[model samples]
Target: MKRIEPLSAARRGVPRWLRRALGPVLLIALWHLVSITGVLPQEVLAGPSVVLTSAAKLVATGELQQAMWVSLGRALAGLAIGGTIGVSLAVLSGLSRLGEDLIDATVQMLRTVPNVALIPLLIIWLGIGEAPKIALIALGTAFPLYLNVYAGIRNVDASLIEAGRTLNLSRSAMIRHIILPGALPSALVGLRYSLGIAWLALVFGEQINATAGIGYLMANAREFFQTDVIVVCLAVYAFLGLAVDFIVRTLERIFLSWRPAFSGT
Candidate 1:
């Protein structure tokens, strides 16, 4: 009888990176096959190969890089502004009932209104300038981050806080040593969500009277019926969102290393 290999041993032969890429590889293969099969019209949906070619051409011309940089700047600026405000508000509210009463209700009410809906008013007030676009991204990113950070702080163990008190820790010391560390995991979770929302907001905000950015490129492509260009812009958006999420995950691994939950990584 032929010797049977252990599953774990067999799996060890596959590179981890390859395993991670398997899903996307399969997806691209399926997409290519579908394109060749003509299940959808080429005008409606360009194949992965066509998108790749379009992306290469755009890159060679430096158009994609310039557009990407413009979009990236908008997204990052919005994220920085929104994240700062979110964390600040969350810290205040999480630390005191008075702050919660003052800030939480207004934030909650505003949360009910979609950020995209604010575009019209933003345009009217801020015009088609970069201000409205950045503001829209900020508005879209803030609430999720605020909610997450607040929840994380609130969810920190009472036992930990009490233990800090037992050690005669000062209020500020307790927050710095215990509360912040305990709340970090949740905050990172919020960061990941906020990054996703920032990208989404960028996509929406950039479409409005945009002269430079991935969304503008997509809009321009749509006007001329350049399906491949539109697809390339979409791929860039997807990649940027994924890249930000990966960065957040890296931060989590670095900061959350003390936790038992992350010991495996």
Candidate 2:
């Protein structure tokens, strides 16, 4: 008789995307189970069903849609400003010792201070309008990208530089062909990190005496003890983060197609 394989040893037939989705599915199931069983009180944490209902109500009222648009606009604006500053500084500092000496020290010092802590100063400087909020998001995102891109540039293989030298490639050509491509992977990683931080910054930024956004919804919910609404807002933040992350991952797959790396099958 043929020996039977254990279940764990059986070849997996599940699609990769389905497998990836299983984790969230299982967690939601467990959450729903605990919620209905009263393992956690609704006051402490609302059930997924309640949260879903709350989300639906917000959607029907168009409140959620408006808030989402506002939040997305702020996050995108901040990202654009921050990404430009981060990449420009990284390229400058990474390419030349003099530039590094001038900029890196200041960046290193500033990054150690929490971006949120600057809210008071930022409010004083830029006022309670959108300026402070956008500036805060930009501040939070810049450091991660700068660090990664700078490292990527500095870490390009010495042999590649030697090869470029042998080819008599000019400074600009060498950077364009060898250095920048080598740094692309790291820069992509920085982008992913920056995107995550941008959402986080948005969370804090929106809470600053704001009249709109998901954070504003949560803040209002807090005053009324509307746990379900708060939970819905929290879920919105999570979903937004996941959506942006998916976009970045898609970009990576497209840009890094030439780079061979082991897929953890």
Candidate 3:
């Protein structure tokens, strides 16, 4: 059996920053070495230097910023729509047996259906507009939130619930005071874990008859064999994901200050 460490008592070293940075610094050095040694064809896999120059060009022309804004807007729009619906339905499902049985099976079935597989049908129905793209990201984001919230609500300790009941708390009062607070951490985790999938769904969604966006830029570059542009687009993807995840982690730290385990345990 795999051993599990108890996070409640575990703590990381204060100077862990250096250790954390070492892996990425080594990876970058290795990449530079491989490029210099001609381990890979330059035309297919351009050097980091070329990618940096292409990125500079894009930034100078404001193309990078424009594409970044469009992608971010789409992702946030979808997030708003999906997060609202997920939390609402999750609360309903957890509160009532009828709601749980009705929505749970349908959600499972939809989740099993690959989001990419819906692209063609979405393009046909929504016509490659913002509607289709937003819909795709929403679909990708919803299930995770639903699963996390439902699990979180269901797992709240019975003792705490009984205490609330003994205090003569109303059903709504218990949910608001005890259940939601208990479930908030897991729901936040779901949101944090979802940043990558939301970004990916936006990329794929933009691919359908796309006119603008970094994904479009990257795909168009592939046609002319511009590996540097492809690399730059991918770098943007990496940077954007990193920036968003950092923000989420910071938010988690602020809201979950009571949870010592999340503080590098």
Best by lDDT: 2
**C-alpha lDDT of all candidate models, in order:** 0.91, 0.93, 0.85
Error at 113, model 3, angstroms? 0.3
- Shift in Å, residue 246, candidate 2: 1.0
Off by over 4 Å in 3: 1-14, 262-265
Displacement of residue 127 (Cα, Å) in model 3 is 0.8
**What's the TM-score of each model vs. the native?**
0.93, 0.94, 0.91
Q: What is the lDDT of candidate 2?
A: 0.93
User: What are the C-alpha RMSDs, in order, of all predicted structures?
Assistant: 4.0, 4.1, 5.1
Candidate 1 Cα errors over 4 Å, as ranges? 1-13, 262-265
Better of 2 and 3 by lDDT: 2
Tell me which of candidates 1 and 2 scores higher on TM-score.
2
In candidate 2, which residue pairs get closer than 3 Å at backbone N, Cα or C atoms, i.e. clash? none
Q: List the pairs of residues colliding in candidate 3.
A: none
lDDT of 3 by residue, 1-265 (tens): 9888766445544457797889988987888789989997788698888788899999999998998888888888888888888878888898789999999888878889999999999989988778999999998888888889988898888999999999999999999999988888888888876678899898898887777888889889989999999988888888888898899888878987876673444
C-alpha positional error of residue 141 in candidate 1 after TM-score superposition, expressed in Å: 0.9
